[model samples]
Target chain A: MANLTTKIGNLTLKNPVITASGTFGYGEEYLDFLDINQLGGICVKGTTLHRREGNPYPRMAETPSGMLNAVGLQNKGVDYFINTIYPRLKVFETAFIVNVSGSTLEDYIETAEKINSLSSIPAIELNISCPNVKQGGMAFGVDKDMAAEVVKEVRKVYHKTLIVKLSPNVTDIISIAEAVEHEGADAVSLINTLLGMAIDAETQKPLLSTITGGLSGPCVKPIALRMVWQVAHAVKIPVVGMGGISNARDAIEFFLAGATAIEVGTANFIDPAVSLQVIQGIDDYLQRHHCESIIDIIGALKTA
Target chain B: MKKFIGNLVVSENIPLKNNHFLLKLTQAEPLPLMLPGQFVQLKIDDTPSVFLRRTFSINYVDRLKNEIWLLIQVVGDGTRSLSKNKTGDSLNLIYPLGNSFSMPTATQSRLLLIGGGVGVAPLLFLGAILAEKGFSPSFLIGARNVDGLIELEEFQKFGNVYVTTEDGSAGEIGFVTNHSILKNTFDKIYTCGPTPMMQAVTQFAENKSIDSEVSLENKMACGIGACLCCVTQTHQGNQCVCTDGPVFNTKELVWQI
Candidate 1:
């Protein structure tokens, strides 16, 4: 078997395929379909400092090759996970990276401090890029200084690996990526859902309750690749790329674009075991190419 | 862990009343244990516009035959495409998702099941279950007109079947709430259908102070609890309809009666 190991900052993944936050729902949801430990890592749901009711019903709408979700980080708070959810998750050998999101700087810091104590958790994906929320999510991520500030504050209290998730809705994604890297972010995950909308033609009303939602699936793949490529070339920290990665072929495109690893987002909704197929598919590609390891293809995009 | 994703071959596709079709599926392996009001997330092939898997309530489960039945109404592209499935064509499914309807309490003997239009899908399964349990359930199914009323013979096999139509072309007319059957005292009520019809049933149950439950059909993406898309506000907070319930105690709902 060709070596599939890849690193994102200090965190080492058995493979380069990770299930995206909000899509995988703690790793327990897919137990019926595949072994959770087979994954490189699983980013749990986007959790907040306090319980959020999230948005109302009608939070999603289907579009061509994609879907829109305004499910604004509805979780039972970080303490609930650490107390009730974390114990169950501890049995899984795969990395369980909690996706941390907050409405304020203190919320982020407090949430990270609590998670920092959990030994099973290896990293925290600072969700500064969730576009569905009204505050603190995409707000801090779109601005370079605000992105740096949040990562800087969380970095102080969070004693483990901190991966800053970046928003693709921003005009200059590279600047935001570089800013977080300068502020002690160990690695960065790029292309959180691009903001989009859908309308019911007959009803002539917005399909989603929030009117606008983050777009994911195959439609956003090109834009995600562009941003990952731009950010990877700009920042020294390892880039964890994601957005519309449904299969291993899509994943290979990201690796060539300098993404050290890729996250499978909306694809999980279609097939719960898709991440495992991606893992197997990646291995098949490496062996077919006679490549010794996945690292050989990272940032190896042929410009000539 | 009991739920799974697998491909079940289409054994037969029998067209029903109108745009509706009874899709009977079978596999070499036994079908998973599905409940009366549970559902499946079916993956649509050849329809790219229908990006997400479409959710449908379990119409019936033929455990002895290792077959499952999904009563589909051609509402849009996703369902229409599914209706076109031929025998031997395989369909990917995530089965037995969401919670099922609750069984009757010891003191509760009288049973009422109200379903509307295609919403009557799951009640047939529930009616069969109730009959099997010796509950002798009564069904109050409604539709826009006579043609809209579906699966009467199937429901009849389980228990007494009653129906209402707006045009009065069928049984005792007006909405299902206006049917004379509601006048009878019932120990328990179960309903699934269009929101307005289910709401009417809920209003009746609440007014009588009788115990009742209604299955919700909120739009869903992930049939598992993962996607927060399908949620219903309850007294406890907003709970996911996919896992928390496709079936919920009418008492728990925050809806105004």
Candidate 2:
């Protein structure tokens, strides 16, 4: 009987378990395995104003307990999504949030404006924190000023809920979160993959073609939790927390740390049904604690 | 189209030359239709260090028996652990994943299938399917030595089989590209194996202006396309090897060769 409903600005998610962008492709790849309607929200792959070919061969490398990737936001541009992908996704009952990315401010505005025109897409997660791309990705996220500028311009064209994704590579994640909040961001999501690299000892060469790639998985949980706790305290808007969250227990930690909703990223690669399992686990935990609603536990951390 | 995660009982484990083992797995449910060049991701439950599932090309599929065969080479931690499995032991698999090899057109009758080492796994399935369609495809396989060669008898049942070994103990003394079989005019060629050997085959096919396809084996995490780890550069752009293809026409690939 516990209520899993949560709100981020004007948007109300059925549950707090949203599939992270890039991890879930337009929500079609997993349809055969599980029902897409069960998810609270599906954040489609990162899309740009123009088509992107992505990085070269060996785009990913497996680490100790994680993986590094430099896919560089590969997609067929926003036009194709609107014309082809949007129709297939419009029938889904769950919220469809577009993860918009660009190398320039105009690209962000154009893409966001296009997404705003699509009635089916309820929101857009502005990806200023993608570490794979060479130009605009982490560059805009690492600096508070660039992050604010992109959000401010996109805010003009994008009428839907605007969630700015924060980068962990920054020295002060709170500053970037506050900047986005000030620029009219409805919510903020953190932390996009930590920038890391791996080397093959035998060959003495970098494992990935893009020498340094974004590291994600269970290895990044602790760091992601700490940043979410800090940013959630600094900003008044809802905070969508994610990083190496594999199970429900991991997600509960994020809720307790003050995250309104949670996104499951790398775990999707490990188990496609992980998000559904997490949703079921949350319900079980709330019942076990005799809690009536998820809000009762959100940011309910006990610190001495 | 259906993906299953079930514990398959190992009905037979035949040890082959060069640390290779042919594992025959049987399940209670009916086996799904698996095509040539499609692979299965086997979860390594026994080993702790290897967390990711190991992928193997389907060597054979027997629908009536509800069984399938996996040709595994004990090269890494995952494969080495799989080799230790017994007949009664159970292993989990997510199967019938990735794109399959394209069947040759009716006009393209003369066909050649090439494989190097364990890369020969998918070729057996491809050869069998082609044979069933009334085409006898020639197979040219390469290995390091006589012991390195495997599954010759199963391959012979489909078509003319030729072998090349680094040591001169096999049918031909050099690499598959150097084998006498290459001199024959084949309308279509399919190859999978070491990168160098595949590239060589691709080059030879290009020289003769014949249609050719090559299967690539990239390191993969999810057998599905969710993880973009196993992407290969093609003439069109970068495509997921797990979803877009494990098999692609040589013309589609942008290899340096």
Candidate 3:
């Protein structure tokens, strides 16, 4: 039997299939379909300091082999998560990571501080790269200095595993990843949705209400794998690779490109059981190669 | 609500109109309790263009025979793929999702169920359950012309069926609102159809001071609440149509009408 266990900072996961934030709700919604505890980790929806109503109607548009979303971090705030959501999630056996988003540096620290106080939540994925939000999201992620500054501030308040999510909209994604790692980020996850827009031909108008939205799905996989490969080589911290991963074969590619763990995003909408299948596929690959542990395959890609 | 994911064998595929077909699927296991306004997500096969599951409201369900029926209108690639299904073929479905229409109470005997085009699908199930509950509800359906109408006999089995077509080829000569059935006061009104028709029904119900509910047809990805794509704005803010509801009380909706 192959050992699927892997470590991300201080945390140890049974597998490498964590449900991406924004796709998996608060972890309770999918409990009826599959065992939430079986997943490597569950990154709950992007939580903000204050309750947000999100963007207006027609926030999503379907693209070929992918989808565009401008859901502007619509969450009920950190207080609701602590007061109501946290208690309900405490019983889960797997790791529960909060994907924290904010408009300002103070909002990020405050949100991180509150989550740090929770004993059950072992990590928080700092969402400095959400492209849909109008104000702070992509702004910090695009610039190396801004990205490092946000991670530097949150690292002071957040005591647990800190993973900074990087945006693909930037020119030098590796620079931003290295900057955050230099500022005490325990781990890094990339790449957040690429910025793209669609137009309705008949109406001659933008498909999404926001005009432009973040694009995600199989369409963005090649770019995501390249970025993950580059960042893993540049930084010593663990890297979580995710972008358009739909099946086990797609996930194996991420591991080969150097991801300590993988997050299943839009694929959850296509198949809720995709993460479980991905875990099994990874185990099968390990067995076929006569490898005893998944660590043997991390960044195993051989190039000319 | 109980949710099931099973391979349902196609028992029958009855064509209703030029574009509509009634697909009856039976599972080996006993059918779970299903309510009106609830829907099932059907997985599309042999189509790379369509990746998401297609959501359809329950047209009818026969628990005794372990059968579930879906009224599919060939609109796009997804439904077009479903229309090609033959008897004995198996379909994977995730079912009994979303909330149901509010059942009429003992005092609220006079009920009105309205539908337009393919939107009349769920109303058949609603009318069937209401009839079984001892309420003889009236059903008003609208289409472009006589040929556009579907499953009139099935609807008639539960209540007095009234229909209106733009070309006067059916029961009445205008929109469903133009039908004389509006003259009779109903205790409660339930509707699902074109947005314009539903809005008209809501306005008529509002004028008569009658309680009204509507099921919206938003473009959805996951019929389960996991994907927050299918959202409807209500008095309480944005709610997932797949989970919070495909059905909502008219008073709760923030529609201008």
Off by over 4 Å in 3: none
Candidate closer to the true structure by DockQ (higher is better), 1 or 2: 1
RMSD of 2: 1.6
Ranking by DockQ: 1, 3, 2
Cα TM-score per model: 0.99, 0.97, 0.98
Can you tell me which runs of candidate 2 are displaced by over 4 Å?
none
Worst 10 residues of 2 chain A by lDDT: A56-65
Interface RMSD of each: 0.8, 1.7, 1.4
DockQ of each: 0.87, 0.57, 0.60
Q: Which candidate comes out best when scored by TM-score? A: 1
TM-score order of candidates, top first? 1, 3, 2
Error of 1 at B98 (Å): 1.2
DockQ of 2: 0.57
Candidate 2 lDDT at A261 equals 95
Superior by TM-score: candidate 1 or candidate 2: 1
lDDT of 3: 0.90
Question: Fnat of each prediction?
Answer: 0.86, 0.38, 0.36
Clashing pairs in 1: none
Which prediction has the highest lDDT against the true structure?
1
